[model samples]
Structures are given as C-alpha cells and as structure tokens.
Target: MSYLRISDTVVETYRIVHYEQTNFLNRLHGGDMLFFLVETGMLSATKVAKGTSLLASLDDVVFKKPVKLGDIIRVRAETVYIGNTSLEVEINAFNQNEEVVSAYATYVKVDDLLRPVPVGVKIVEENEEEKRKIEEIKKRRESKLSKIADRQKMRFRTEDITEGIRYKISNVIHVSPELTYDGKIMSAGKLLKLMDDIGGVVCFNYIGYNNSTDYTSGAVVTVAVKGLTFYSPIRLNDIITIRAGLIYVGNTSADVIINVIREDMKGLKEHVATAYFTYVRIDKEGKPIKMPKYIPVTDREKNLYEEALLRRGLRK
Candidate 1:
C-alpha cells in the first residue's frame, strides 16, 4: 500500500532533558535514554514499513558520556537493513555536539494476529555513501551474531534457578490511550517504562521483603539493562500480563528477567516481549550492600546464571 525508500525515511528528533528525565544525581537516567532511542528508531521503521511495526530486538548499547539535565539530546535514526518483514535501524544520540549513546534495533511489520507481513516498501540508494553505509551495517550485524554464537559455545558451567532464593511478581493491566500511538498501537517507550519499573520492583522485593525484615529499610537502583527483545505488538486497551523474576544474585547486584504477555480472544497467553535488567541494592546512604547468595537448580536457570555471569564480565 506504501512505497518508500530508506533515503526518505531517515529520522532525526530532539528533546531537552528535564528534571523528570534525570536521576537523583542529575544525570539522564539510563532508562530514559533507552526509551528515547527506541522511540526515535521506531519512527524510521514505521515510515519505511508504511504502517505499524513491532520491535524485535535491541542490539548492545554503549553510553560514552554522561548526559546532564538541561542538555539538548539529538537522535538520528537510519534504516541499515531491510528484510521481507523486518527493518534494522541504527540510532545515535548526541549531547552538546558530542556522541553520547549508540544503539541498533530490529523491527518487523506484522498483521492483526501479530504475524510477520511483507513491508510494502522499497529502497533507492541515492549515492555511493548510502550504498557503503548499507554494506557496513550488514557486516556489523553478521559480526554481532558471530560473537554471540562463539560465547555460547565457550560457556560450560550452569546454575539452576530453583536452588536460589528468588522472587516472582506478576501484574495485569489495561493499556491506556495516553500510552498508545495512532490510537491503537502501544508505544515502545511505554513498554520500556513498564519493564524498568517491574524489574526494579522484583529486585526490591527480593532483597527487601524476601530477605530482610523491613521492606522500607533499603532501596534498589537499576544499573543497567542487559538486553531486551520484543516479539509482538501490544494494542491500546489490550489486557497485558507482565511478570518479573529473579535470575541471578551477586554480592551487591542482581539480575531480573521480565516477560510481557497478552491474552487472546480464546484466553490463550501469548508472549510479546522479554527483558533482562540489573539492579544494585543500596542502603539509605546510597551505599551498596552485600546480598544473599543465590543457588541455581534447574537446567534453564543454570544456563541463565552462567550467561548472566558472562554478561557481567563483559560489562565490567
């Protein structure tokens, strides 16, 4: 129904960081940056798809500089690759003319049932630069997949989830109109907010209510989001079920995996998204405290635990 090219779909947006977007330290919250990245990238994808698109996966992100409140953040998003039903976008954010954050993500065009559909679009490379950029992105995507495969093959040890002191929380909520775009599709920014909030709650409850006497005695702060992948789109007023559970616990840090599910007309549950968030437990004085040891039991838990360790190693 729509014919478009990447050259015409490249997106650029800007926002001024405000107090609501900053943390206690007056620095832009990692979650806020992530949400903005996805939001800006999705616009380019939608432009190319000529309609709604569902976010599939977010690539590894690196923040090079701290973004301060009142800074003007400019985000540029470009489509790097196009598949039968998907688009991969590379987005970068700059503050005060300096690059601060870089990320890439993939999204798919879908139908009412959330099944992949053809993106009615075409690409017209305008010049040699555009051609080279496409080639570069292709190689980068291939290199990233190769690294993931190599890491999996090298991993050996496994920790079971059942053996650990864990916590699980689930909530069902209706998506409000304000959280949606185009009067129907839920925005990726809202989904990120849900994940961050739920992940923090799971970590806090596991550390405070589950392990300590007074839940109000301490607090939990998100240090990073390991990864997040979306499988389907959530529509306005959709009944969504979000669940979070403890996956790994370190000396002063913990990892939680959150899943988003939606109920169909037949009452069947369908998974829409999954994300991993890392949190650090802090005392009233904002100092990290030692956490209880987590033991893994099941095979899946063991694999996740080992992978978490690997990711933590890479992060450090």
Candidate 2:
C-alpha cells in the first residue's frame, strides 16, 4: 500500500478467453469491455487511495482495436497528479498483440455523501522516470487543458462552460472487408476500438502519456464510461471525431456530453453515441474526493451544445 503513488497501477493484464468479453463479431463490446478496463484502474485508485478514492469525474475514453474473444487484454492505470483533495488517473487497455484496445478513467477520493474529501495517500519516492513522467503531465495540463477544475462535480451540467475548450475523441479505422463474416463491413466491437483509441488520445495520448504508468502512480481523480453507441459501418480510412463538453457538475462528479462524427462519409452526419457515466474522485484506497466549487459556463459552449438531456434518458 505504501508503494502506491498518484499514477502507477496495471492490474488488467489478462486474456479475454471467454465470449462474454466480446460482441456479435466475436470481439469485445465497446461499452462493456471498456468498463472492464476501467474496473482495473478503479481498483488501483481505490487501493492507492487506501480504499478512500471514489470516482469523481471521467473525460474522453475511446476504443482502438477489436479484441477477439480469445485475444489477450492488458489494462494499465497511473496517477497523473494529486491536489490537496483530488487526483487524476489515466487508464489504458491493450490487446495481447500489444495493441491498445480501449481507454478508461477512474477517480479521486470522496466522502460518504459522495462529496470530495481529502484523504491521506501514501506516496512512494520518485525516481528519474517518475520525474520525467510528472514533468510531461505538467506540460500537458498546462498547455492542452483549458482550465478544468482540480476537483469536479457529479451530474452533467446543462450549461456549457468548459473554459473555452471542448473535449474531443476520434478514431481512424482501416479494417479489411475480409474480416467481416457476412456482408457487414465492420463489427460493433471494432467501432468501439476506434472510439476508445480516439478518446484515449483526447484524454491522455495527445498530451504525451502512453503505453502504461507504474502501479504507484495516480490521477487527480478517475472517470468511467456510462455507456456507448455506434453508427453506420466504419470502413477503412474513416476519420471519426468524438467531442465532449460540460453538461452539469454535481457535488461529487461532472457530467459530460460526447459526440461522434465521421468525416470520411458524405451525406448524413448522425450522432453516433452519447452517454452518461459517473465517476467518484478518490484517493488510492477508494475513498471519495472533494470536487471544485464551481466553473462558470460560457454562452458559446451552450449554443454549440446539443441540449440532448431529454434524449439521454432514452439511452437505457
């Protein structure tokens, strides 16, 4: 327990030997499989937080490849940074062939009422590699982030105020038609891989973090995938974009809206999937973490937002 830090856990290094982890295409389901990746990260956070960490916020997550039912899956998690009360964890799930299949988020610590709480976290001594990792994180947070909260709220905010930034998740799928059993071009699992990869990039890769972090590392807080959806067949060379914006911030978590759009196709640009996932901010032990007070919404964000709160309810 004392060996854990804000960003260092890789619990999911197993194979998807059963059909349960896959989809109709004999591959992992985008939403279900991603959740499994998240579970590994969450457990790590909970362990490092001394069981005090709770999921507080979740940002962009995407799937990159289709994990066949028998393929090996590897999940890794690490703490990005730790504040007085909150921390961030980045989760990455890969396939047996060393290909990343999905991305996920766990949270910081929280209280019994689901409120952010600052709990004691055991920090291990930092090494040269640790120093480099932390510096890279600082640079990314400083450069890319538009000033999200060190602590977040629960509940998707109806207002748009992401500090002039919109979260984006995208995927580039170049699958062969031969892989399809029937005339179907692609399977839902493959689509999920694309989304997870894109979302992972938006969440971590773009900044710099990749591969996997150590077991002791941790993030400010962790987030989870509430749900997922897929649109028409995604063929080879399709450039897809997934954008997430602030919806609402509850006392314990932040609600975000995700939008998926395919650029390769012409004609209709339907909304592929939108979901609501809740995460608790906690320490390494799974205790809850406190969230920020408030973040002001912007008029532009609101205007660009889809205001699909009503449609979200129908996603069950």
Candidate 3:
C-alpha cells in the first residue's frame, strides 16, 4: 500500500439545524448530530479505502454543548489511524468556531462481497505533533481493546425477565430504500439515530414523563454514548427490531442499553449492534434534574447495572 498524509483523507461538511431535527427542547437532537458525524466519517474513511467503508464501532462520544436550532454545524472528519483492514476516524462538530461534540469511529473497508479488505493507503505523519497524536490514538485503541475483551467474557443466562426492568420500548421498522446508502445496506448514521430515539424515550418514560401534569415540562438529552459495536450489516428491506431498556439510574442521569436485531426474509434473526447511551433529564430551563431510582433484581439486570457503573467510572 502507498503512504498518504492524513490531510488527504479529510472530509468536511456543514449543515443547518432545522426545526424538524430539533428535540422537544428545540435543540439539535443528539442522534441527528450523531448521524451527521458518522456520515462525514464514513466519507473520510472511504477516501482512504478507495471504496466503500462501513462503520465497525463507535466510542468516546461526548456532547459538550447543546446545538441550538438554526445554528450552523461544521463537521470535520479525518483518518487518524490505519490498520490492516480497518481505520479510525476522529470527528469534531463545531458551531461558531467552538467545538460542541466529538467522537471516534472505526470503519472497515469492505469488498463487493461485504468482506473486510485491506485499505489501499497508509497514513504517514508529517511532523512531531502528528506523531504524538498517533501515539495517543494507539493508547486509546489499546485501552478499548482490553475493555472489549473483558466485556466478551461476561455471560448471563437468558431466562424470563422476572423483575427490575421498569422502562423499556421496542420498535419494528421496515428498512425502506431511502434508509440505505447504495440501495443495499442501511446507513450506520440512520441506525444510530433510531437507536438514540428509542433510548431517549426510555429515559423519558423512567423519569415519569407520563405522570407529569405538563408534557413539555422537561426533556431527556443524550449526554454521552459509550461503546457501540456493529456486529452485522442491516440490508435493505430487512425487518429490524430495535429495543431499548433502562439499566441504571444515577442522581441526574440514567443509562439505557439499545439492541438491534435484523430479521431476514427467511425468518432468521441476527443481532446487529448494541450500544449504551447515557441521558440526563433536564428541566424546561435545560438544567439537569434528579432521576428516579432504579433497583436491579434479576441476575442479568444486576450484571448490566454493574457494567454501567464501570463505564461511568471510566468516563470520569
């Protein structure tokens, strides 16, 4: 493979936050922002791959500031690390020259058969500063790998859920042609938006949204998204089931686990991806408020709760 500078793989795009894209708080929805980030990242990765690149995983997504409606969002994505067949893209979203959100995504170059293929280019650092950045990326990748290994070791019995799961919601959607990128596979950005939508609903329901006298008194906003791993490709016309369940609750925030399952025409169901989203209940003034307590009773629930705690500690 030939060596290429990181600048050669950079992609920048801009969008205006429309009213339809805003949440109940009249701010840009986290999921919509996520979609923009992932889409731009994919374009950057594709430039390096010289072909199609699919999202493999996303991590360390931080929402630093809320993007208001009518604000212009500038998104920049570039290939920061290159592996044999995979590359990591760092994306930053800015408004008025100030960064509001940032995320890191991993993409795998795939061939026509949807198999992982070697990326055609390698990244070459131009200066000492670039070299130091690459070193940091390597360290973060190593830490993430170690965590993934530990997570894979955890196993839980799949029995009937006896108790402790208070807030949960599931949605079944038919993957239409518009949802796909090439009329074959669904875009990762769309999938992430769907996951966040359901995750936000779970958080709102747990915070007694239905019991409140005023429906628009408060809102649930995404604070951060932990590790999101894509296991399979969602194809066009696939009947996908997205499920979101509340796992842990803190003083002002809660963690929701979202799982996506794809069902083919043959009635075969496959686990597509799983992600953990952290949401905070905010009052009408956008101030964070205390969330209701959640107690885990089942073995699975307890395990998930502990895992959420571990993730929270790592975030700090």
- lDDT of candidates 1 onward, in order: 0.74, 0.47, 0.86
Residue-by-residue lDDT tens digits, candidate 3, 117-229: 88867899999988998888888888776766643322121122213565788899999999999999999999999999999988877776774546554778998997887
Off by over 4 Å in 1: 1-8, 111-115, 120-136, 139-165, 206-227, 250-253, 280-301, 310-316
Off by over 4 Å in 3: 146-164, 211-217, 314-316
lDDT of 3 at 227: 82
User: How high is the lDDT of residue 85 in model 1?
Assistant: 90
Candidate 1 lDDT over residue span 224-287, tens digit each? 6645666456777778877787888999988888777776555655567666777777665567
TM-score, ranked from best to worst:
3, 1, 2
Clashing pairs in 1: 159-302, 160-296, 160-297
TM-score of 1: 0.73
- Please write out the lDDT profile of model 2 over residues 1-316, one tens digit for every residue: 2445544553544546487654334655555565555456666666666655544434456444446677767777777555545555667777755655444343556554445666455445268777676676556444423334321221222232234644444333334564332333333344434444344334332223333434122212224454443223344444445555544444554445455554454533433444544333333443454544434356644543334333335223
Clashes of 2: 100
Best by lDDT: 3
Candidate 1 lDDT score relative to the true structure: 0.74
TM-score of the candidate numbered 2? 0.46
